[model samples]
Target chain A: MIFDDVTAVWNQFNLTERTIEHLWMFSIALTISVILGIILGIILYQHKKYAEPALNGLNALETFPDMALLVLLIPVAGIGEVPTIIACIIYSLLPVTRNTYTGLVSVRPEILEAGTAIGLTEADIVRNIRIPVSLPMIAGGIRIAIVFTMGIVTLGGIIGAGGLGAPLQTGIVLLLPDVIIVTGLWVGILAVIFDGCAGMIEKRLTVRYGEW
Target chain B: MTSIHPFETIDRIELSHLTKTYGDVTAVSDVSLDVIGGELLVLIGGSGSGKTTTLRMVNRLIEPDSGIVRINGTDIREFDEVRLRRNIGYVIQQIGLFSHMNVGDNIGLIPKIEGWGKEQIDARVHELLEMVDLPPEIFSARYPRELSGGQQQRVGLARALVMNPSLFLMDEPFGALDPILRKQLQEEFLTIKYDIGRTIIFVTHDIDEAFKLGDRICIMHEGELVQIGTPEELIFHPETDQVAHLVDANRKYRHIETFTVHDLMSPLSKREFYEANMPVSEAMAKILSDETGIAVVMEGNNLRGTTSRQNIVRNRKKNLLLGDITTEPITVTPEDALVPVLQKMKTKNASSALVINREGEVTGMLIPDSVLFHII
Candidate 1:
């Protein structure tokens, strides 16, 4: 009967509207954070002076607990997917931004000079040479950000965001070990899936860019 | 056979007292030279001698601190920066081919930048790929990463020439190549120069390369122009001991024609001549054999001048075997070195010499007067 209950909870977990909503919230946060993180990374790469100050500020922000950012966002965004997404984007910005800046700047000066001498305009150089050459490093940063965001997103449930985190929080409050184990397993599986996807994409980008 | 006016000659590059300084260090010091239309000017010197700086100044890649650089009498500074760069082709030691771009796009860059139409750019790319000895179909789609160093250099040259610029500035373009590839590229560059007829300001530290390729060689030393002249002029009359040492290193290769064979040949033109088993009387009928007091020699179809009328007169010993009284004159082929010829003449006490073909046939006589002509 215990095994039946556990199986029933497992089947119901994926079907529940709140669980589905939580998954949707996690997906939205991940997607938005990745996009915003990449944009910020590119910005930091283009402006060296801004990179130091901005990265330092973000480093300071990262030192704060993830729950602190989640709680801080609730007053403004009112406990929904918006607050969760904003929090994830902010948290993910550091790795992606730092990595992109480092990668772009690390390109050999001769390679950039070759591009310029071959008559590539500044914009074309950035788009074609600098960005493509640095894409491997950028992808690495995004991979790190994805894993970090995945781990942190579960905390979003504390602020009324949905997904496996909500059920886990409830299971812990109600002392339901079966519910906790099921929800924890789902979160673990989701993190592994997110990590695997990021790793594959990073590898593909590295191969495409001719980076070893 | 067209007349090239000094003023109207296209591809003529003139640097008028050009100077460049980086802080306290003078990179190029008041160097002036003219590379006439269609001439290859080689700038050669050791490291930090300003040969490269001087070459770059012509293209305004390194703007001179002072002085005018003109192309066909028009100041280069007068043109817009992009326009000026487009008109002067530049190739550096590091080939600098864009790694991210395909070979065709890299080669087509200048034309595309100039707003050439799609058809024009495509045709230009293919034309240049073939011009550089690379087939377009095979190489066009490949990236720079797929090419060898030599192939990359060829593509770099094609990129430089995409706009068909009249002046080419090459800064140690072959410096990084292996010796064999360097020689090959040098030969190919010479052929390209002959075909294109652009004014080339080629920089190198190699004296052999300078002599092999330059129509005019400009030697630089310590940021100053030491000497500028043709290879012969520089070899014979180097301006300083430094220039002399540079020329002296190449002296062994300078041909004998640079000095006259006459300087060491015998002055006598009289000798006895013999016809195939003929009587002396008939042999005397030939003007070259007529003089009794001379020793005539056979050279191919005609009898050459005798050694001396006096020697034949004194020996009047008859049956006068042709070999008996005939003095074997010192001779040299046209390709022999002047130093060796001089040493042979001094050892032989010869007043005149015979210019002979490979088959030992005399083509001409080198008299003492001919030797004086070169010196005077």
Candidate 2:
């Protein structure tokens, strides 16, 4: 009887189309976040004097309420997917940047000594040694970013981004418990699926570059 | 086979009035020394003695506050630091091979950075790997952690020598190895040191290491150069009290180097020998009551073996022949130098060795009791 009811809800709301929109937002936001995070990390690693303060500022951004961030972006960027995607990136930056910077700086001292002693230029050492060995740490940050991205994209439906959250919103306004339960449960399942994929990718990266 | 020629030229090195200071601590002071071409110069000192600081200055790793380091009669400052380092071999105690790199890649990095053709790089890598006793086909693809500590250090040595540089700067290269491995590497290095005629400045806090490898040893203390001379010169005519004490560390065993087994062993005639067929219980009682706690087992005076109270005590209840419990002892010639005999003692962990003279005669017993007194 529950499976029949779930199918009825799924068709009436067109959950399949909603799922596509949700994935589109997540992919875009995570891609942008990974690139920006790595660049910012490199800058912070080079300017060690500002690394703590800069990371602290990003940490403060993390403390801002997620929905509040989407609403706040609405004034400048208008509503819908633009503001939603921006919110996801803003929330995801701290973990990725912090991890990238820590990975670059935390390379063992003797490894650095060997690099210099063997005549690797400063930039070459960063490129060949530090970055290659830091793959696992950067992968971990991206994994955390994937979780944040998924959560924010789900909330995107409330602002007319039309994800699974929209049906839950519809059910909430009309007080229909069946629609609410089905959409909420479906979004939770999608999050777990996305997180599982991210975890698999992170594991592969760890195997290649973790121990060094 | 190197297309580069910088190494073939600069073989002599001269340091003039080198001094370095960090805040209030002077790491090295007025240290001037000359290194002959193709000779290994060992710089030795205890911790904080500035020996390492002095070596680093030559490579411009740590620039001196005031000094002139000339290689082949030209100032080192005249050469670019990056190129200078690439051309000079460097090895350290940590054996800092890049973990991400396989053995071949690690050695090939220096040449690759210098823009060598791939075939040339591969050939040179293979040659150097062979030189260090790690064959290319088997070991080249293996990661550093896949090798043991001794094997890793050999790769480190091969990596440094890949450039075939005229100069080498080694800092405590074997200090981290176990004693057996350390001794093996030292002997291998001595053999390699002869085949590759290059100027070398080796840094070590270990006195024995310094004496063994150094063509001439330079001693430093409290940021100052105390003396520089051959091992014989430093040991026999120490210029300062600190130098005397530093080299005199092994003076307790100085006779070990000079004297032979003939000069040091207790003659065998002083002891009573026993037949090999003696019963275990009887031998145990005799060895326990004897003044020396040792019984030399003879097969018709052929010196079959020897047993101690510790050896016989375990077999006292068994009806075994004395020969069954007796352990074989290392044999040495009376003309054999005490230094090699001492090495034999350490290798087998033997309590003593038989000092055999010519004409198949066992003339004396070189017990550790007599020699270890000087050794300890």
Candidate 3:
């Protein structure tokens, strides 16, 4: 029976393990993107001369098609999680870096002057005034990166990395409608749940920092 | 009240040949001045006059191109830039209170930077809030946007004074406020300064404010020093035609001269002698009621001279008595021309005139405005 095969397919596949794998790969990519993006943003801010070139380069990285980036990395990094995570990090860098830079640079001049005039050191000004005022924008960038990474991690399964995407690809190869439907549902659900968490984090941070 | 400055004797702030340039345009060109400690020296000029540049130079906000700023006779360049700024309070027209922080945090910022303990900073914030007439319990947690313009400025003043710095640099600090609020804050600032006694360099385009608040005003025009003198000196003896024009706006009231009451008082008429002790307003009311428009001002039994409605009006304060209004009748002998007496009255801010004979006998009377009308 069709129902019997569909049930057998569900029993045969390790859905939980693939979802966990998907989350781990996405988390690794997101964490690296966050750290690298913020550092690059700050570096770009400090040496403004480097900002133009660095930003143009980052824009190029973002403009690279997702699958092409994954394919390009496969030659050196090979298949599986290595190339998949590398692709995810590159795809996520633009929003986090650009937004962090925007947040820091866009702080009001009068506020910065007030900070300096009050005798705060450069470090103190960055920590006390610039960072706090720019946090909401930075958080928005983080949310975007996290959601984008979650969606892109689906491609990891094509490279033989274990994730919710593996079954969806298998179903397409075999032309099985039921397999596609169930696995596609899981992908959409996983993406929404992770994106919601990121959005919640953004909201919490923005509320804590207060509006500028 | 604490000893905020390390220097024992901070007597003067001297700017020597101070100059600044922005690209091709000169913002301040070789301006020099000395301000005594506790003195509020007003720098007055139109836009592009370099008044603000000159003030900012003292705090190194705008570093001068070629000259030096010496605070307490020591070159400010010798002091560490951060430490120097920490010891100098600054307030600008924008009243840049940090929007992120509440009132208490804003006021406590300098102390925090100076490494004051949390308790000490909190206590000081409360104290400054009270000094600025904003109670801590109500204002401490409130952000700057919650405050009105005047209130935000008071917070700015509190923030500046919280450091209790050796000097204050105010660049049109009250320029953002409307006239009435500006006047009120100016008075409040004077009272605050009286307590703090911090040497302040105040910059403004307002000549009247310069006259009111400055112990000495330095006028700037096109990045050059036009003149520097006491308000009275500037008014009476303008060094340049430009200054004369700058001050001409208030020329009508700038005249100052020594004139006795007798010079402007009229002679006794049929009106009963009003004692010097009578309230000026009452005397004015009486003079206005009387058809003769004059009251004989008496010192005990001796009739001094007459006062006109104009004199009473000019000298009248809310509770000022006739005695306070009565000056010795500065009698102009009958030989004297009306023009000279009127000129003296104008200078003296007097309105009435006493026409007396050579022996100083009370004769006919003259009110300056009325007498000038007849004689002209």
Model 2, position B331, has a per-residue lDDT of 89
The residue pairs found clashing in candidate 2 are: none
Candidate 2: tens digits of C-alpha lDDT, residues B38-125: 8899999999999999998888888999989998888888877777877788999998898878899899987887789999998998
Question: Could you tell me the lDDT of residue B20 within candidate 2?
Answer: 93
The most accurate candidate by lDDT is: 2
On residues A65-116, what C-alpha lDDT tens digit does candidate 2 reach at each position?
9988878887899888898889999989988999999999988889888778
RMSD of each: 18.0, 10.8, 13.6
User: What are the runs in model 3 whose C-alpha is more than 4 Å off?
Assistant: A1-13, A193-212, B1-9, B249-376
TM-scores of chain A across the candidates, in order, are 0.89, 0.94, 0.91
lDDT of 2 at B356: 73
Comparison by TM-score, 1 against 3, better one: 3
- TM-score for candidate 2: 0.79
| TM-scores, chain B, all models | 0.65, 0.70, 0.67
User: What TM-score does chain B of candidate 3 reach?
Assistant: 0.67
Clashes of each: 18, 0, 11
Candidates ranked by lDDT: 2, 3, 1
Q: Over the full model, what C-alpha lDDT does candidate 2 score relative to the true structure?
A: 0.82
DockQ class, candidate 1: incorrect
